[model samples]
Target: MTAPSQVDYHDVLQVWREADTIPEIEHAWLFDHLMPIFGDPSGPAYEGWTLLSALAAQTRRLRLGLLVTSNRFRPPAMLAKIAATVDIVSGGRLDFGIGVGSRPSHPLARHEYEAHGLPFHDTAHAVGSLAEACTVIRRLWTEAEPFDFHGTYVQLTGAFGNPKPVQGPHPPILIGGRSAATLRVAAEHADLWNIPGGDIDDVVRRSALLDRYCTEIGRDPASITRSIHLQVSYDQPSITRDAIGEAIDAGFRHIVLGLPAPYPADVTRWVTDELIITSAYYDSPI
Candidate 1:
């Protein structure tokens, strides 16, 4: 994963090039925030889909995804088409991650939303809209005929999603967040669920809750894969190992991490040689 505050496009390409050297690294993601984060409002605000589209041409081996995008950023049908296009460009290496926009409490986030003329509402409303958005996206991806969508937040007439995703009916929909409504939506719809930096015990508790929700919905609990967006980075080698080790112990197979943007390229080799190479001998979590 990458957060592009200090890192420019050149740095991003370099990071991907270094990542290509590490065979154990299966996926790289970008954070999907609209504005400059970490208190750098003047920093270049890299959009997620644009970055993914560019990287699709440059990289070959690793799968690609954004950590999570807000449904409020684009219409569901349009997002579906974009996702399908990107997946096609990447030869079916896409994980469509998304979430409710975010809390309106953050200073930058609030400005980003209101400034863009997007809704700045409560978390509950956003979550409900996100659920509806996912429904529309999935329908567009899978259903061959045009259909109408009437949801609380989005309404469409005769919506169509042509040239379906290369990854069969749809690419993996990775739902973010651990709220009750969010979990229920994930349990019903998501192929994967991402917990963005949380305690292992808390993760375990929520995993159980997800399973219960899946069972309640008559869906297989094991259908949804578990992933974590780890806070550790390549620079802190020991810390990275310890954090990843803990996550592995807690039953997460897919470990997603965003290294600090402008770190030395050799940091990738350092991480691969230490944690990724060692972890290869272990059993798969899923």
Candidate 2:
């Protein structure tokens, strides 16, 4: 995963293009943020979905997507259309990741909403809207006929999606968040659940809570794949390797290594060699 902030487009393209050729790196990702969340507050931060579409058009054989899109940024129906377009562009390699925007606790994240003239709702509103967004997006992808939707957070009239995503049914929905409310939404809508890697015990507890939510909803908990995003430490590959091992042991089969910028020369190769291949759990079936 590469945060598209504080980096050039060519640099991002270079890393992704390299990763595409490496079979070990199955997927690549970009984060959704209108402004720089780290480094210079005024630094350039490319729009994620736009850049994702560009990357999708350039790469083949590697599944790709925004690490998770912010549901608050765009209307659900419009986002469904955008995602479908990207799926078509990528020949169906898009993994649709989304979340309930940023948390209010993070000052950097909170500022973007106001910066872009987007409302910053309370946590309850954000979570509820996310649930509605998922429902509306799925219907837009799968429903053949135009439909009307009325929900607390979403209202649509004659909403329909044409040129359905190339993927049958729809692209895999990957929801990223650690909140219990978000987990409940994931229990119902996500094909995969992702949380930032740290505090392995807490992650395990969250995973258990998701399982309980799924059980309560009569959905198989195992149906949702567990995913984790572990930040790559350029200076110490061993640290990342240990984290990967722990995440895998914790039942996270999908591991997304977050690459920090400025990306080194042959960074993807370095990732495959030093981080992935040398991981203690590298020999274990993933």
Candidate 3:
């Protein structure tokens, strides 16, 4: 098994940045996963794009990105522009996670259409849209001049994205979802696949399936990174250390932890302590 390589923490804005001095923290910053069904509705409506810029400014030496951003929230062209801007702000520290949009009824079974607007929305339609969106994002990033694209869902004539992302070929694209359609899309387009928390058996199974999908699609399975998001509550003093180690042992290249909102001093304390110690531990490798 390939040894896993990283551990990431999510939703770190708990307590709203109150603590003593910010300690040196290492590891990827998994930004907001949701895109505000009610307009950035997570404690005071911090726009995801703005928050990412702030986080990048606040932290140094840590990679930053959204764990996953849904497709429905914005257009691909706009997303590409926003991501490029963030990448520039961070000096190229951004990684992006894209997914088929998720809304209230949670996949919106046809029966739940009434609850949500727009006929419960269709998963296949969303998936197809997301795939096309991915194509658009990449094309816009690489195209030297403003270009034209015509798609079933998106139509752009002479769209020029300026100040392209600092990262060559664009920041890494981490696609999220466990469905076959999602997997297929990732295989064709994504640089990484974000898997949510599950048991070891589940991880192994999903990993294998993803590998197979990549093979079927003529993609090099090794080229794609595997990132998992976990809702972790730690009892141990060195929780982050333990968590990162565990994830690495399980063959994940990247790991994301979902922390509560409101930014607690204790949360910062633990993260700082754990990150400093973990960096030391990994520096020399046991």
Candidate 4:
């Protein structure tokens, strides 16, 4: 009998500390998701795009992204330009996953947002901002060639997008969260949907809801990709299989697994040996 199918193989690039390691890896990988609190507090804070640009030079096949950037961090126009630049440098391998909310608060419940003079305490604003940002981003990417944007929150006049993204329309946009509003945004604008920290039943239910929403909006449900975020520390084969099975069963073709630390050799090897198989599985029929 043929061997069980495999899942796609990719790596997550995170820089817990500055180090000179191998530049290129065996498979496509994501640029580490940067959190403001993850780095030195007193030192200069490095933006996510800057880190991705540097990683682009180091790795060839490795894809890069913010995993999910909070909408409150940067204005839509500024963020669009930054993502475009990364897409160009990475040869269109950049995948941007954005959400309205932020990483859970640490010692305090609201660290990142409050630092920027916003109502960091509210989750509703975060969700709303994410929706507005997604619209602005897609317009910038697919506007009939650099047009004016006059939205309630963002406004631009006769703006022409220069050095457009390498991807045809734009890099793949992944939207996170499972709220009704976020689901609608994913169905309408997002290329992929990411929902993490939920049960299998929850995942299945949410996926069905997304499909229904897509149909309600006259879009082919299959056109929108499904993805999930996972936390994996050990390199056990069983762990890899379980994660891949869970994601596939939930109707997700994309699995974004978080690394406990940045670029661990063991984790990289595990991804190659196990997750790479899944890519072939996707290509071949069951």
Candidate 5:
């Protein structure tokens, strides 16, 4: 995670209070989808990259990114350039998340794939594409001179990604998933690893596996930040506190609370008074 400047507690509260005015949030995330397959099925879905550019321009301190942008959604070079542009626009506050589009077999997911004419490849293909895409993205960001990439899944020639991200090297690459293939990708390339909420031992097991992968690949496991997403509603303070503590103990620094729709003001106040005030940590007020 990118470290933000220290601010007084009241200042953070002020940002929270101004909920409508560039609410000070630590990070904001978007989802990649052609339609609301999980919800309305026919409702509108914002194209993550376009909306993210808008968000980057609108906010000042909050980190803007996708929760997990599907690799199926864009070409590797194109997504890299889009991420770099947003990082520059937002003053280097992009947590660029990405994932292989290896979704579990579900009717909704199948429908989405059919609707968009996107291939619903097996997990192995997804994993391969993800790894190759990561390589291409990183190369575009770091290479000073144009280069060619010919991989099993992705190929590019005479490619150069200009206007590199404001973040040195590139913006934070946050990878999300618990599958072995996904974890391997995280160990190889991610600056942050995000998983769903689980018990302490769950984290321990996954971290150990990720560590093994990191070691095999000659990467330092400690270099990656651990994160998890926990669903939250207005009246679940106890759930929130307990989840946060569990995640912290399990070595996760970033806990993304999955806020169910129809956001509540009281929940925000409760978070400010209990979670934020008690911990005395700076967080985005989104």
Candidate 6:
């Protein structure tokens, strides 16, 4: 995963193109943010979905997407169309990831919404809207006929998606968030659930909560794959390898390694060699 901030497009493309050739690197990701969230506050931050589409067109074998799109960034119906277009562009390699927009606690993230003239709603509103957005998006992808939808957060009339996504039943829905509310939404809508990796105990606890929510909904908890995003450390590969091991032990089969900007030469290759390969070796039974 690369945060499309403080980096050049060519650099991201380079890394992705490299990763595409490496069988160990199964997917690549960009992040959703209109403004720079780290480093120089005013630094350039390319739009995620746009960059994702460009990358999708360029890469062939790697599954790709935003780490998770901010649901608040676009209307659900419109987002469905955009995702479908990307899926077509990528020949169906898109993993549709999304989440309730940034939390108010993160001041940097909060500023992007205000900067873009987008409303910053309360957490409850954001989570509720996200649930509605997921429902509307899935329907748009699968429903053959035009439909009307009236929900607390979404209202659509004669909404329909044409040129539907290449993936049958739509691309896999990967919802990222740690909140219980968001987990409940994932219980119903997400094919995969992702949370940032740092505190392994918290991740395990949340995974349990999600299992409970799925049980309550009469859905199999195992149906949703567990995913984690662990930041890569250029200086210390061992740290990342350890985190990967822990995440794997915690049942997170899908791991997204967040690569920081000013990406080193052959960084993707380095990631495959020093991180992914080593982690696999360490995780294997002796």
Q: Which candidate leads the pack in TM-score? A: 2
Pick the winner on TM-score between candidates 2 and 5: 2
Over 1-286, each residue of candidate 1 has an lDDT whose tens digit, in order, gives 7775556887887888788666777888887777876756777878889888899878887788887888878888899999999999999999999988666666877788776788777877788888888899989989989998878888999999889999987899999887878899899889999997667889888888999999998999889988887765555667767778777777677788657756665766765776666664344311
lDDT values of the candidates? Answer: 0.81, 0.94, 0.65, 0.63, 0.73, 0.92
Lowest-lDDT window of 10 residues in candidate 4? 1-10
Worst 10 residues of 3 by lDDT: 1-10
Error of 4 at 96 (Å): 2.1
Cα error of candidate 1 at position 14, Å: 1.4
Q: Tell me, what's the RMSD of every candidate?
A: 2.0, 1.1, 6.5, 7.2, 6.1, 2.0
Model 3 lDDT per residue over 1-286, tens place: 0001121124443322422144343344443332223222332323456677776766555566765666766779999998888888888878887888564455322222343343334777788889999999988877898788898878999988888899998888989888878888998998889877767567767777889999998888989888877654545546555655666676775666555443344865565455434543454211
What are the runs in model 1 whose C-alpha is more than 4 Å off? Answer: 279-286
What does candidate 5 score on TM?
A: 0.86
Q: TM-scores of the models, in the given order?
A: 0.93, 0.98, 0.76, 0.77, 0.86, 0.97
Best first by TM-score, ranked: 2, 6, 1, 5, 4, 3
User: In model 6, where do residues sit more than 4 Å from their true spots?
Assistant: 280-286
Q: In model 4, what lDDT does residue 17 have?
A: 15
Give the alpha carbon lDDT tens digit for every residue of 107-225 in model 6: 99999999889999999999999999999999999999999999999999999999999999889999999999999999999999999998999999999999999999899999999
- Can you write out model 5's per-residue Cα lDDT over 184-212, one digit (the tens) per residue? 99998899998878666877799889999
At residue 165, candidate 2 shows an lDDT of: 98
Clashing pairs in 4: 6-277, 6-278, 7-277, 7-278, 7-279, 8-278, 8-279
Clashing pairs in 6: none
Q: Which residue pairs collide, candidate 5?
A: 24-284, 24-285, 25-284, 25-285, 26-284
How many angstroms is residue 41 displaced in model 5 relative to the true structure, after the best TM-score fit? 1.6
- Model 4 TM-score is 0.77
Model 4 agreement with the true structure over 245-264: per-residue lDDT tens digits: 77776677776655554345
The clash count of every prediction, one per candidate, is 0, 0, 6, 7, 5, 0
Model 5 lDDT vs. the true structure? 0.73
| CA RMSD (A), model 4 | 7.2
